[model samples]
Target chain A: MTDRPENDHWLVRPTTIRLLWWVFCIVLALTVIAQFGFSVKGYFGVDGWIGFGAVFGFFACLVMVLVAKGLGLILKRGERYYDDGDSDV
Target chain B: MSEILSPALILFAAALLIGPARGHWRTAILLIAPLVTLWAVWQVPDGVIGTLSFLEYQIEPLEGSPLRRLFATIFALMAFGGGFYAFRHARWYELATAYAYAAGAIGVSFAGDFITLFVYWELMALFSTVVVWCGGTPAARSAGIRYAIMHLLGGVILMVGIVGVALQTGSVDIQPMLATDFSTWMVLIGILFNAAAPPISSWLADAYPESSPTGSVFISAFTTKAAVFALILIFPGEPVLIGVGLYMVMYGIIYALLENDVRRILAYSIVNQVGFMVCAVGIGTELALNGAAAHAFAHIIYKALLIMSAGVVIIRTGENKCTNLGGLFRTMPLTAVCGIVGALAISGFPLTSGFTTKTMISQAAATEGLVAVYFLLAAASAGVFLHAGIKFPWFVFFQRDSGLRPRDAPWNMAAAMVFFATLCILIGVFPEALYRFLPYPVTYQAYVAGKVIFYLQLLLFSGLAFFLLLPLMRRTRTISLDTDWLWRVVLLRIANAVSTVLLALGTKFATLASGLLGSLRSLSERYFGQLASEESGRRGVFARDWPIGVTALWIAVLLTAYVFIYYI
Candidate 1:
């Protein structure tokens, strides 16, 4: 294994990144809960329920990632897969 | 001598001059060609002009309307900007071919009849193939062939439809069509093929990234947008397009999310952006049509800008995968900045072109009570940000330093990016400049507070999801299979199997046939020899030794015997 580059970027420092994640989580939770107090006409009536966008966005991403991973399992191959002799047909 | 100069002809004619000219003259032609075309476009007043009778049919090669002009103007501007970007870096032939391709698009924009449009449609296919070949790699060559075949198929489908329409209506005039019959359905399928709609959508991602970086930028602007323009003209209000367009939008996002290549992500998003326009065309309201046209215009600029920035990265580092790129912001600050601006613009940040233009499409859906379409478009907006807006910049410029410090883009390329970036913001800030040119009069306002807030909320939350799922989004050295797999793998394997079986059967048949022929030859030779000996013994002399009279007598005797047998 090669040496990792020294972390000179302030934003990517381990502690700072963790802190940023925490702040993001707090903000996301607030936005989700804010749906209860807000009367914004949601695209679906259910969207106005607490944490809808958050739940929808997160689960959608999760499902997409999982589906992609499953697809990758079947479809993924070596970089030279198409360049190989068998594919020349 | 002519009343009006066809803008497409101007570009096409100028394209011929580019190859022969050298040094500064080439640059001058490159700069002036689009300018002249733009000027010619302006000269075309509303209604058909420059009609020429061909084969007893009046073909209007130059028709002017707000929509045609709008599409033509952007195409011309795209050629100029793309030319400027590619002038110094790209080979001369590539630029010439690209100009020819652009001319085809401009021609399609102004074509008043299906015949003229079909001719130019084919022209784009032919020249763009050369541009794809300009990538100068084996991958590019094969991909170019596939690209050509797909387009040829699309052209044939479109031709059949055009012919059917002409035969049905006895007029070849450009007009709206519903998919009420086989003819119109063929036409819709044809246009959708170019638009990179599903079942054939893989062609866009398969081919575009395989082109030379500049070629990809040039390609990003045309073909599909021209298809969008065609849809607006020929197949607007067709309900099926909404489903097709939405499929493309989601397909692009899902594919892009799973993609590892930097330029490829941008390539997928082109389909995504065109999806918005296609969906709006389906909506078929004045507002939706306007939104479609306006969104197409914005999409071209921003998408090209996005691709151009990625081109810079590809040029500088010579690495295209996200796995091989990162931390370019330190040294290639200018490229990073320009790329970020493009990213923001594409993400529909409040003051970006995408926000101004794409929002109109969603709003039209909302107003029409297309609740499902509205929600999905909203979700797609966030997905666009996830897959393209953030994913492109994050992985390429800011992920982790891959320890490659390459120089920023050359001055000319950077200048091109800056010019487009400026336009992205300018159009966003003052959309009226673009709105004035839309096919319909503008009445919708873009910057209401509630809409902005909801959009921000949706996008920001999606951003949060991206970060939360960052671990899952890491780039790898593998490619995701797409619909092309059917042709590339399954169909090819089947062909190979059939050919192998046919070869074996052919060889076996040849051997058996040869054996049977040998036996027949031997049997014939033996029988003939026996017959000759029997006839000679009866005559008691060879033919050479016998007199002519004797030979005649034998022949007559044989004939007499045969006649006797017949009588009996």
Candidate 2:
């Protein structure tokens, strides 16, 4: 097997940086839009709970990610965990 | 009318016989079993068959009503279709076990009493677990164990409630139970568990997807639908189910939105579809109950079609993750088209089975003046389109090409998908056929233009939301977290930790006790003549003659003391 060159690593790749920047911009846009949209809806005599729901949705997503990571630690067996062929057909 | 055989008996006998058979016999048994059962189901008369005495309860095995027969007929039909689909792919044992499982579901549908229902309920649990294990994978084994535990837990609760009802009411007849008794609540919880209600709903997604592709198709048809049938029979007007059902609808939408595996997404949506039925049962109007029944029938067809299409994809490409799949329409056009049909049906698009059946439930809510429920359900309809209708087909079949070319589905799988897709459209266009089979008379129409237009707008906008939110809904290489974490992670960890501590303590206690005995033996050897001989001392107190005699004497002395004290 041939050894990989240093430039072949993903972190230093130009494409990776470009992709990260795109993702960062998207997230920022979503956050801004969600905040403004909730406020505008609330101002127009829509339910004030809309603001609360928006905040709750953001946090819920965050918590879901964190909880999923924690759960993955406990429940993530090897890829082959369920692939053992010892079970009866 | 001609003499009718009992579907339940035929299925049970087939299950018993198929276990020992090899190649051709097994295939023949699998193919013929459902056909026989279907014929038997068709023969059920429109009345109660017979009742037996069980303790203080009367157990009715066969009850023929239009509603019961409707579900029974469809279930028998599903078994035939599913059996044909699996006959070529699944192992003989799997086919046999699945047949037995299908029988249990049909049995529950025809059951006239709680006792008969509970018996078949447990049977479905047992046989479905066997079907899961038939996947012949380690994951399948663990999943089967978890699946069995959850079902047995539900079955025990159901059994306890049945016994309680029998003891208090002195009857086990299956009828509308409106009482708020402990037994009634227990029965509700038991049924809810099977229905994939909150907290424990993860079992359906976790277990069913882990089954073999063919096995998953059969697994999709029963269990929860049986629970829906039970709910309609028992708790028709229970208002609490509305909230529970609403939660499931959103849960399915959100989780499926986040899912990666193709089959897992479908599994989550099953809970979502069943949620609509459960909510209708809560509404408890004739229209709502009819809606629930019609939805169940529609759901079985579309869901099976969806799973069957997914199964074909998995078999063809050996990939199930959407991230790893796309551009399959080019090669597997038939499967893709069938899958899209299923997706539309599931999304309640116009001229589909879901649109015809699911709308009645929402209409029922509106008529009942359940304003909040109606709005939430309407929004949930949008969410359903976002998650299942657009996302599923888009990501799996029409997304950026993954450049993996695979052949179309095999003849059997294609035929199954075609059959179900045809049923979905037929029911959608002519819902009267389905409506006539309801427990009540048909009076509702699903073809109103205003209603159809409203649904189209809501769902179409949801599709817009999906495309607009596409960046956020990108497929990640991760499994979504669900309530199964409680059992699969938390409870499992606790059990492991407790077992470890116990084992450590046990070993330490054993070692220390042996050491103490060794010292005592040495001391005894020095004092008493050769009683603690090397070979004899190592065997410990119970194994030694001196201690044995001493223990016998102590027991004898204690007995004598007890006798004297009592007598005096």
Candidate 3:
């Protein structure tokens, strides 16, 4: 590893990261809250529910990650899983 | 000469020349060949302009249409772009094979008959396997072999379907097909295999990342997208495709989330992105077809750009895994920027080409009152943002520094990337340029305020989720098994066991039979005379062991015949 000081880049500075996270949250909230500003419509009942895009997007990703982790338990193997002669079968 | 020349032949000629040409001559062919093909692509008039006799069938070598031209143009452009990126680094043979592969894609694009189409399809499968082998590793060789098997199997199924249809209908012409019959279903499954649909989807993620850095860039553009072109032409409105496409979209997302290799992550995303197009083809309306074609057009530019950026990293640092890559944005600013652009474009972020094109598919589904499909597609879109949009860039470029400061891309590669990156944004801002080339009338607008806001909310919150769950996505040096385990692991084990049992049985039988025959031969020799001695029989040349490749080939031939007979 390079012996560069830990927080050399401004983007990685702790304060800057923390401030950016706050700004990011505000932008996220505004996207959801801005829905009320517009007349939101949906072809389906569940989609038109308040904050549906936010809720759906969040939970959808969360579910995918969980599903992936669950599947990985069975499917994931060492990088050399198929390399050994015995395992090649 | 015929009034119309096949652009495929131009690329093929270049492929032939690439092997012999050296230095400036090689560079000139690489740059000039695809441009010539591109010009030839535009000059051909629309429809099946001409046909020639192939046995009893009149095979169309070239046909021109808005859609065909669109795919061909991009393929030629990719040949140009990929050539420009690779000429300085990749070996001559890799370039030659990649050009032939591109020819296969262009051939499929303009093929008006099943005969011509199958020829091109097999051409692609053959050449792309060589491209995969260009990785020059044992892993690449194995993966290439497996990839070849899967695609060739797909080709056989497609050919059977085509022959069945021809026998039934008395025509070789390519036309819209439904999966109502056994024949058409085979065709659908065949195309779906290449589209990286379930069960067989693993071949793509299996083979692509195994290829050399530049080879992967070329590998990404064709194959599946050409499958998309086939799906667009042949199986549009096949209802089963909607379910299959949705499954692929979700599968790509989930697997990509668990992936450590940056190129593998991108490979899965190809499935995810193509899923959108496949589903759009299934939707099978004017808007949906246009959406599929336009997205394909935009996708090649951006997707190639994305892999080119990854190739730059692989070329410079020789590390493709997320665990080994980080803080690359420090030195390789251009590559980082281009990668970010591709990631955002792929996620359908507002004002990107994906935004302009992908939304049309969702709009098509919603307009058709496919509420379940619409919602599912939207969720999958969010998932795309998580795994590909955020996960790939964050891990490879912006995570904790791995203390690797690789040099930026070479000028040729950088120029190629800048060229594509400009297109990604330009298409996003002005969808009309792409829309004008669609197969049908283009009336859809991609930039309405409400839709943009909905997508922004959708994609951004997914980003929020990505950061929140970043810990769970920690890269590990492992592989996630897909349905390919059925053959690579399960069936292989069964074959091994069966072969073991058979070998033992054969040995026992040989010993018993030889002993029994020896006694009978002693009796006969006592009575009259033995014709030949057992010692000489055992020492003969015919007693030599058969090669495993020969056994495998015989087995393949038997299985293929069995499938053909059964399907018939």
Order by DockQ, highest first: 3, 1, 2
Model 1 clash pairs? none
Largest DockQ belongs to which candidate? 3
Give lDDT tens digits, candidate 3, residues B199-267.
789999999999999999999999999999999999888888898889889989988988889899999
Error of 1 at A34 (Å): 9.2
lDDT of 2 at B119: 85
Off by over 4 Å in 3: A1-7, A45-50, A85-89, B524-568
Q: What is the interface RMSD of each candidate, in Å?
A: 3.7, 10.6, 2.2
C-alpha root-mean-square deviation, candidate 2: 9.9
Candidate 1 structure quality by residue, lDDT tens digits, A25-79: 7876666555555544565566555555556655665666676667767766666
Chain B TM-scores across candidates: 0.94, 0.91, 0.92
lDDT of 2 by residue, B401-512 (tens): 6878899999988998899999999999998888888888878889864455456545654654566567767776666556675666667779999999999999999999
Q: Candidate 3 - CAPRI tier?
A: medium
Clashes of each: 0, 1, 0
**What is candidate 3's lDDT per residue for A1-89, written digit by digit as tens?**
43555547777767888999999999998887887877456767667666888888998989999999999888887777777523321
Better of 2 and 3 by lDDT: 3
Candidate 2: segments with Cα more than 4 A from true spot? A1-89, B1-5, B16-32, B532-568
The TM-scores, one per candidate, come to: 0.91, 0.81, 0.92
- Colliding residue pairs in candidate 2: A82-B139
